[model samples]
Target: MTTAIDSLLQILDLETLEHNLFRGRSPQVGWQRVFGGQVIGQALVAASRTVVEDRQVHSLHGYFMRPGDPSVPIIYEVDRIRDGGSFTTRRVVAVQHGQAIFSMSASFKVPEEGFDHQIGMPEVPMPEDLPSEKEMAARMPDTVPENIRKYWERERPIELRPVDLTHYFSSKALPPKQYVWVRASSALPDDPRIHQCVLAYASDMTLLDTSMFPHGKSVFLPEIQAASLDHAMWFHRPFRADEWLLYAEDSPSAYGALGMNRGLLYNRDGVLVASTAQEGLIRRKKPRE
Candidate 1:
């Protein structure tokens, strides 16, 4: 049986349609729209294929222009922006039905020694101490919402172990910060580029919801509509996506139907690997008249 992780790898393996063009398809998982992380990962793969192997992606900025159409294929068009001595840049546009769904700019750099200093990773319970989804369900069978439980019952490419479950069981307002340990559900190849793509795919998980924390709300709330608007990431160090990594995230503010969130990813050894920032739509939907 093809595992979910296997399916993810297959989707990331884009079909090269023509020079500077690639085609990617979404997993037919019954989602009304394509997942944002999938697009980011696929677009990065499309860009990475055009860059020299020695050059690794150091930063990427993307914007979602429209909801992706999962029923059809997404065409990725890569623009060879520049190839400097130490840095290479590319711009990618994801198109569906001849309309642009997302656009991104990525920069790749040849590994070089540099002055490096990073803040300390927060002290939190490691994955070993945290319970798995099945355990969580068993421990709090009565509290887990049916929709949320159904979502977790499905096979996933990434496994998440959140540090806190209070918010799920209670609607009380809480701090805007959250910590989650995440990794690919299964072992992955040794290729650094694939690891980067897989990490990119996982970045979109359990984020944006940080913004709703202060409002005593969650993305799962029926009245709330959530969507990623823009995303930016800076890769600081090499890390394997198959190993546990801490995703420490916080939301600074939310206003006028928008929420801003930031996350710092650290490997099990506490090395900061990547930092990401995203702004999302968090508007409440109109009630039926």
Candidate 2:
């Protein structure tokens, strides 16, 4: 298996050092701190392990308590909050340096017959027409600003093809909604759980940035600061993370140093597998001359 695929699988193997205590390592070559996606992904895996096969994860809500240390392995403690007939709930606390760096609550639902209807997928160019974010980053010379380059370098495992690259950094105003094609660079394991959690991990990246386009601000620009405060996702259908998925995101509001963004995940077949919403810290700093 390729290294990216291997990382997806290795992430599932939570080290069982003690009862109710699971250890997780970092996927290095990224930020100074642990990637938010890694903690979110690993926490979902930890929660899923404690639930029965019949009950599958349907929704998850998480909060970033503190910055995670990439140098230290995270210890997850799963609390079996409730196990009933129709629904089961699990709480996972990710700790590093003896402090809770992240916490998540996942609810699993037993399969049942239900009526369903969803909005159709938006029409967009195929992933083939867009250049991968990696390719774009490679074109940047060493002269590129460290803050801007680090934003691109820290990204791996998943591939991103923005619909409008210039809009991401341009000083001009743009639309509130943005579309990007995303998928795992390498194929994931056959296990359905791994694919779902990996999708959850990758979902956190760039979706919130869609909101900033309208304001002509980006983390790449010196005047803005961005961070995810909380994230929530709901699984709607089954899909593969290795295959292309259209991530259509939009931000309806940005005020009080925060931005609200929502996105829908659509597979190449146009199946809507998931929906996500997040509110993030969108603080503005003084622009440098």
Candidate 3:
């Protein structure tokens, strides 16, 4: 595995503090707050550890209660809610500084035959047809904003290639829809739970940003405040995180200083593997007197 993927695996590997409790740490990336996806993935890992290997996660719902302190370790406490014949439920709370920073409930089920149906994947350029993250950074024009250039040039565990680049440089209001091809920077182990956790980490990457597309705003803007409030995901089929997947995202509404966005993740062969929904705080900052 590449260093990036290894680092990600390390981040997901939680230490057992006690019965039903796990401790996780963040990478020292100089961020003021921990990444929401990291919390979600780690919380899921904690919940999964308590579940039987025959049961796999099918759905998860999480809420970000407070900004996580990246400088310190997070403690996750899991509750074994229920264990039925075919379904298991777990609730996890991630605590930092003596308070809950995030909470999540995950449900798992044993594999069973079921009717299958999914919406067709949208037609878009494949990952190979788009500019690589490194190439995109290298081709950035001088007029491009520094903050955006920094984001493009940063090395991350997941590589994203947007189908369109207009929104990156322009503030023009556009449709609240976007498509990005994403995948882990390196191969991962053959564990399905690991793949699911990694995908959960990547799910939060760009979903909330789609909410700002119609307003021609971004979380990076100094005058705009954006943070995820709640996140939900449903795993539909098995998939590998190291393979390219299309993240088709759109915002359905933005009102009352909040935005709601949803996404469908499809593999290269057009099979829908997962779906996500999120609501985020998106308030514009007032000018100082």
Give the C-alpha miss distance for residue 41 in model 1, angstroms.
0.4
Of the two candidates 1 and 2, the one with more favorable lDDT, higher being better, is 1
lDDT for each candidate structure: 0.95, 0.84, 0.95
Q: Rank the candidates by TM-score, best first.
A: 1, 3, 2
* Model 2 regions more than 4 Å off: 137-155, 286-289
- Which pairs clash inside model 3? none
lDDT of 1: 0.95
Off by over 4 Å in 3: none
Encode model 3's per-residue lDDT on 1-289: one tens digit a residue: 3487899999999999999999999999999999999999999999999999999999999999999999999999999999999999999999999999999999999999989899999999999999986787789857567888888888899989999987888899989999999999999999999999999999999899999999998888899989999999999999999999999999999999999999999999999999999999999989999
How many clashing pairs in candidate 3? Answer: 0
- TM-score winner between candidates 1 and 3: 1
Error of 1 at 45 (Å): 0.4
Among all windows of 10 consecutive residues in model 2, the one with the lowest summed lDDT is 141-150
Model 3 scores a TM of 0.98
RMSD of 1: 0.7
Ranking by lDDT: 3, 1, 2
The superposed Cα distance between candidate 2 and the true structure at residue 148, in angstroms, equals 4.9
